[model samples]
Target chain A: SQQGEEDPQALSIQEGENATMNCSYKTSINNLQWYRQNSGRGLVHLILIRSNEREKHSGRLRVTLDTSKKSSSLLITASRAADTASYFCATRGIKAAGNKLTFGGGTRVLVKP
Target chain B: TAGITQAPTSQILAAGRSMTLRCTQDMRHNAMYWYRQDLGLGLRLIHYSNTAGTTGKGEVPDGYSVSRANTDDFPLTLASAVPSQTSVYFCASSDEAGGNYGYTFGSGTRLTVV
Candidate 1:
């Protein structure tokens, strides 16, 4: 089984509407990172939130993490057509010797323009 | 561009032939990693090198092998290609071991074995 799993496997929303996706992990982590993959392109780094941090924002992307719940959420405000991509959450284990990351199945999001 | 170049954007190989996917990054990063992306399985780590001259096995390292001889290049080789090895391969690198900053990924190579 994967260490991290995402909810709402797929999402579809209007261009101006907000889009939100959740990720849950099963173990302790040092940090959590979110990535976006546009169709055939490689995964692009979005945001990284440390275990001690609660929330962080970049441009229109907002990310929140809850250590107690072992989960995280990514929210895009006023989404645009370019936001149509698959979102994946990766976790860096706290006890891992190296900086290896465990990735989730990902959430496929589609923005209707 | 973050200075990562992946050669042979796509390739088709015979089942028993051997092939090597080339990956080069100009970021001078110490940690490099290889991962395979599938339909529903997301991405699985194949192999990683924390620094030049050292390599380690990842979550899925059975059929794939990788080597980081220097800081600039890391290549993944398939000893005996098989149909099951077909997948989109990605090469990623981080400034630090944990990507405290972020991970830079290549455009990716689409591989098919038949």
Candidate 2:
């Protein structure tokens, strides 16, 4: 089951630009996580924000979670070609244990040189 | 460090046949999961285990079963394959249940059922 939905199914940006993606979920969650995947590759964990955390940062990435709104956003600063990949949002529910996450369709981002 | 490994990077199976996809995690994580990825549909969970010797169904559990005999191994089985089951399968693991911690995923197995 898909618990989250991401907007801007696809995105194209030039190098040095910032990229932002938004995700909305249907249920109350324990936490929300972001992942990146290159073509034909496994997903790499990017960052996570607990329900109690309104904002968090890792390197050039920033994540904001709004439990009241059941939404989250990921921001990438100074995006480069290396940042070109599909970004996914996953939600872990309150009742679910062991990281049984429900993933969104993902946003495809292409950074042009 | 071989965080996670999946066997048979890809496979071709016939309808009504049976096959099992193997997964192993060296991280000694207590939780393991199986998910199928399809174009435009994203990744859907099929089964998961909170610890060794336990297993539970996920969203798309039909036509799939799983076993977790130890912390290092989790395998997904298809009793009877079907065309609709063709997709890229991923195996993931986390340090604990309730998944506040992020997961580490395998490269995935590309399965084709005809």
Candidate 3:
């Protein structure tokens, strides 16, 4: 089983609505990162929240990490149709190096324009 | 700049045949990885190399072999391809270890096996 598991395997919302996705992991991790993938391309890194950081924001994306609960949330405000993509949460084990990442099942988001 | 280039954007291979997926990066990264993506499974690492001349198995390494003879290239080979091996393959590279510095992924190679 993968270390990270994302909830709400699929989500549908309006273009202007906010979309929130959650990710939970089983082991201690050095950091958690989120990536986005289109229909037929490679994943693009979205955000990275370190274990020591509680919250971070970039552009319209806000990410929060709670080490105590081994969970994290990504919030996309004012979502757009272009944001329609699969979101995956990946974790780097506390003891692991070499840029290795373990990915979750992913959350597929559909934004109706 | 071509951060990473993957050959043969797509290919069809018959079962019991051989195939090799090529991955090259221009970033001079110390780490490279190969992952397979399937529906509902996200992406699973097949193999990885920390540096030249080293390789390690990942989550689903079965039926897949990889070699990192140099820093610029990492090739994944299937001795005898199987139907289950059909998936979108992605190659990624990073300057250091762990997720502190995220990875830059290639466009991906879609392979099908009959």
| DockQ comparison, 2 vs 3, better candidate | 2
True contacts kept of 2: 0.86
Against the true structure, candidate 3 reaches a TM-score of 0.97
Report the Cα lDDT for residue A102, model 3. 92
Residue A11, model 2: Cα distance from true site in angstroms = 0.4
Q: How does each model score on lDDT?
A: 0.92, 0.94, 0.92
Instruction: Give the interface RMSD values of the models in order.
Output: 1.6, 1.3, 1.6
Clashing pairs in 3: A98-B97, A99-B97, A99-B98
Q: What is the per-residue lDDT of model 2 for residues B67-105, given as tens digits with 9 covering 90 to 100?
A: 888899999999999999999999999999764799999
Candidate 3 residue-wise lDDT at A36: 93
Model 1 residue runs over 4 Å out of place are: none
Q: Comparing only chain A of model 3 with the true chain A, what is the TM-score? A: 0.98
- Using TM-score as the yardstick, the better of models 1 and 3 is 1
Evaluate candidate 3 by giving its C-alpha RMSD to the native, one decimal.
1.1
True contacts kept of each: 0.57, 0.86, 0.79
Tens-place lDDT per residue, model 1, A41-105, is 99999999999999999999999999999999999999999999999999988986578888899
Tens digit of per-residue lDDT, candidate 3, span B36-103: 99887878999999888989999899999999999999999999999999899999998875448888
